[model samples]
Target: MVVGATRQSRFLFYVWQILLTAALQGPIKPDPGSQLGGDPWPEWSRSAESLASSEIEQECRQSVDSFLRRAESSLQSPLGSRHPNPRDMLFFLHVPRTAGRTFFACFLKQATPPSKRCAKSYDILRLNVSVEGCGLLSSHDDYSVTAVLPPTATVITQIRDPVDRVLSAYEFAVEVASRHLQVPLGVRTPRPPGKPRVDTRNVWPWSLLVPWMEADMRMRAAKLRSTRDGALKENNTSRREFVRLRGHAGGWAYYHSLASGASKEELSQGDVLLPNLDPYNNPLAMPLREFIEHPIVASTIHNGAALQVLGLTNYSHHRDAAKLRGCVAEVPSVREAMVRVAVQRLQGMYHVGVTDRLQESITSAAGSLGINLTGPAWRGKADAAFEYGDESVAEAEAPTRSDGPYSQLIHLQNQTDAILKELSRKQKELEQLRQSSYNSGSANAVSACFSLRALPASA
Candidate 1:
């Protein structure tokens, strides 16, 4: 039987490789069951001993014991001489792209009371991280983290791959901009007359969302014309170019400068201060500029840096920059998926950094505290059902407005709502699977499914 199983495992490996190659190169889609050609990927990839029914419970008990022992040691002798103040325990720093939503869900499970178990309000770790004199903190934007957390508290964070993070950010921006205009998927809409043109480029002038472009322009023109007649007198051609160029650029910057008390000369300099200025028009420089100037789409891009920074004071063992960089470079697909997961889970919400890093840091910290940071021990049961009621209601009540853009906006919202609901369902299923192993005396069931091997001591 052992020999037969080993042969079956080898056969499954070849099948997986073939399917993966097909998926990458062509339109071939592997069904979940046939992906491994009858052999389960999870069981085959795992060590035979790990899945053996005879010693399953024994191994899990031993693993839990080892983890608890490690945790006790960590809690007794936490790294750093200055002990964390118990009063300032819950530190929630919102890191943008790391797997924050999942982590936050874990936190919600830890912090929430059993009686008041609503998924939306259950921040078990968030509250306990503060009230119990234990240092439980997360990196994500929230009034609790921004306003309530003590100033002296330690901040924690996580990061993801840069390219994936940037792409996620772009997708999020496209989603937002699409909602504000008559744009379909894969289509760009024209700017309305007298409205400031939004350049879908690096700098997203957030203030442009305010409907003051025409009024602000008239004010700036009056100021520019007055300046032209006085101390800033120049040739008519130069003056026309300056005004025309400034107007062409958009009024957000000018209005922002004015609001911030910058002088007219300073504002004028800003208008011409092109960060990507290229007098010789070099080809190499153009691509370099495009790369650097690309807007950060997902928050995970800064996870490595944020974790290292936060770890300086929070943890005794800080991950080396080279190691972090290697990790980011190695897991491009996982990073991209994490970004999409986060954005889909928290659409239009203001908790950017909070989602990615905070939960990861806390989980790591929990592991240090001797908690079984994986399996049923760490998983929480979430009851957030994905209801398509909002989408149905919107579809039934088409607005009376004749504006195409307004109708498009409503339609996009419905689509976004559906996507969000589907994502939420997937998330709930994943969570259930994660927690099921713990409840069923099978600690590593979910990890087994992923075929994750324990890193060697050196790693």
Candidate 2:
């Protein structure tokens, strides 16, 4: 009944009807008592006539409420109390820029035995690897992964503040772009000592986007230097900063000549990707604020967490064109519906973690998977801290004025922040439930459960 109270909720309710119809078409094991024998076509007309719209809505609402209650109870159950199927796999749906690397290294690998871990993959949509006998599968893929996984697979993931995630992703792209350009041209401009370079040219999305990023940075810097004032401004910055920057020195001249003939390379990268329904422009070339507000970037990642959760972020991989908008819907009503759907899906997950609360998140996930979280596995943050030089570019490119671009990004942040809030709430409830079970002497008590404080820093 409550589901039909608002226009947006009503729309969601209607969408559920379509979804239920789609689900019914699938091969579901039928209950012996619920099976209908003869031709049911004639009965359908009578049933539709007899069932009022209000009654249909009420039934739908009851079914949804029942599901929600079941999911909540599952979360509140004592850790390791629920008997999962022997074949039930735990899948980590890794969201980009959510400290997933750290989670995989510090908690996931340490807790689960190597024998049970599935090889990590990003393009799960394209690959057809057998996941049989693997207790854990983690990837940078989205919710569509459930298609290949068993029905009983327990999905787990971490959520982060969208603003931070986007900023981190942008910085990461810049770093990768810098490496790709520098590595091949290392002879012309040697990289600094001890600063490692990775070859991400073979990686997806990055393989597609990083080259464009390099081209964008090169062209922008060349254009800037071409102007008298821009050349004067460039000389004012420190030599070290200028050298380390993406589009300085030989890069400008290189891109300038290439730009005349570089349209082909640029055009290749612009082929319509799911989120970027349109061709990508020189997005990385824009200022930070402009970059955030760019149509391609905003549509793809404005509410990335929810979009990823719904499997709408990678639309090209999936065939459900009607279901996959491939980005955060621009319509306020549709976006609201999307957020609610994402939250509902997240609430039903076996373990939902928050990037901000790393320790508690790890504890809950470890508890759910019945991992002992001790011995050589109990390590403090495996992620490497940023070097001093990495901060140099941040200082130089700091924004002095902001007016409109930030408003849109801030709004986008609010949307993903809602998803983060729901995950945080779930984490708290699980912790409380575990603490209660421990107090009641119903669950086995381990000494200093998940003692992360004592572990030495990763070498």
Candidate 3:
């Protein structure tokens, strides 16, 4: 019996050693490199690459989450050690073509007093003035030390897909130009003729104008950097130093000259202007091809010059190949590091509590003003069947429907139905939440104001 037991024990020991060896060798073993050159394509390297990407994404998220948590805690504390003055407000650093309009409408309604509700955009720019006693100030101005608010002020901003923003901007510029030429050449109503007024509604072709736009953006960025760095004269009275007045006023001549090195006649009357010239017939204007070719603009518009100028750094543009490639080139080790931190930070800070609180604030304020939070009621039924007759025909033809092929189709359909239902429910819930938030915010603001008024002015 003793001999038999020893033999069994030895067999088990051998099995353990084999497993240990295999475990150690599995990861380090070199299989034939998937690609011809041994450097894996993105897809080929996905297994290993994804692991790295995920790690980086996670680290970046975490870092952002931590930073926001610290900021939120600072805002919420009653001791006021982190945020000394409750009156010190948060500016919604508006990045044009983002969701800034919706946010600003909501924010203004909550912050502004009923008497001063119609305050102009200029009124919002002045730093020292209390915005209807909410103390918040915001503008789409370039970065300047003089423009800086108190450090206690929490500046928040939103970012959008840059390519989309640029496309939208182009469309807007075109619309403005068309509107200016209302009496198109031979129209009966000969309108007062002048340069077209630039507004948010015009359509402009950005692809042909890309080089020009890029030059403008670069100049803006350089100017901003100089001003921020104190290289520009402190007393530089040029409004361009403070705000993007040139672009707003239809001064693309400078950029055009810089980009194409072409005379004004060449720019206005050349083949290059074909895209913008015939706005109605252009197919490129509809789907926006710039996203495919010029992805860097997406990053630049959202987080680069725009954010820096607005003094908001919390939001980030979506990741693109350029960002990934740059990180890979500059600091390969830390390439993944920053992304991971941001992901972690976002998850930690942007929680249910913050969203809930914000919603409550929005609802309460809106309710007091009798503004209906529900804009347009959703008309579709919860269980409306989606028409997929022809679409389903191709899906039904697979032979192995029972397990691998058909099961996937069934699962996908189920998921789609489930997601639609969830989305519908969420939309309804969102409307209610917004109403509640406005109410809560109004009450809080009034309470804060009253409390402040009661205190000794000197104190």
In terms of lDDT, the best-performing candidate is 2
449: Cα error in model 1, Å: 75
Whole-model lDDT per candidate: 0.32, 0.46, 0.34
Q: Give every collision pair in model 2.
A: none
RMSD of each: 29.3, 23.5, 30.0
Model 1 poorest ten-residue lDDT run: 387-396
After superposing candidate 3, which stretches have Cα over 4 Å from the reference? 1-86, 114-126, 129-134, 140-147, 159-287, 291-299, 302-459
Per TM-score, the best of the predicted structures is 2
Alpha-carbon lDDT of model 1: 0.32
TM-score of each: 0.25, 0.49, 0.31
The order by descending TM-score is: 2, 3, 1
lDDT score of model 3?
A: 0.34
lDDT of 3 by residue, 1-459 (tens): 022443333332322222112211112211211111101113322443445766655534543445445434543531112331334444444455554545555444344433333222221123323232434444443222112344344444444555555544544333322222222222232223442211221111211223233233233333434443363355332212111012323344221221222333232322233211122222212223443334333333433333333222212211122333233333445434444433332333211112224465445534532335765322222111111110100001111111233334444544564466567779989999999999999999999999999999799
Q: Residues 32-109, candidate 2: write the lDDT tens digits.
A: 112111112224335545666655444345434443354344446422233444445667777777877678666776
Better of 1 and 2 by lDDT: 2
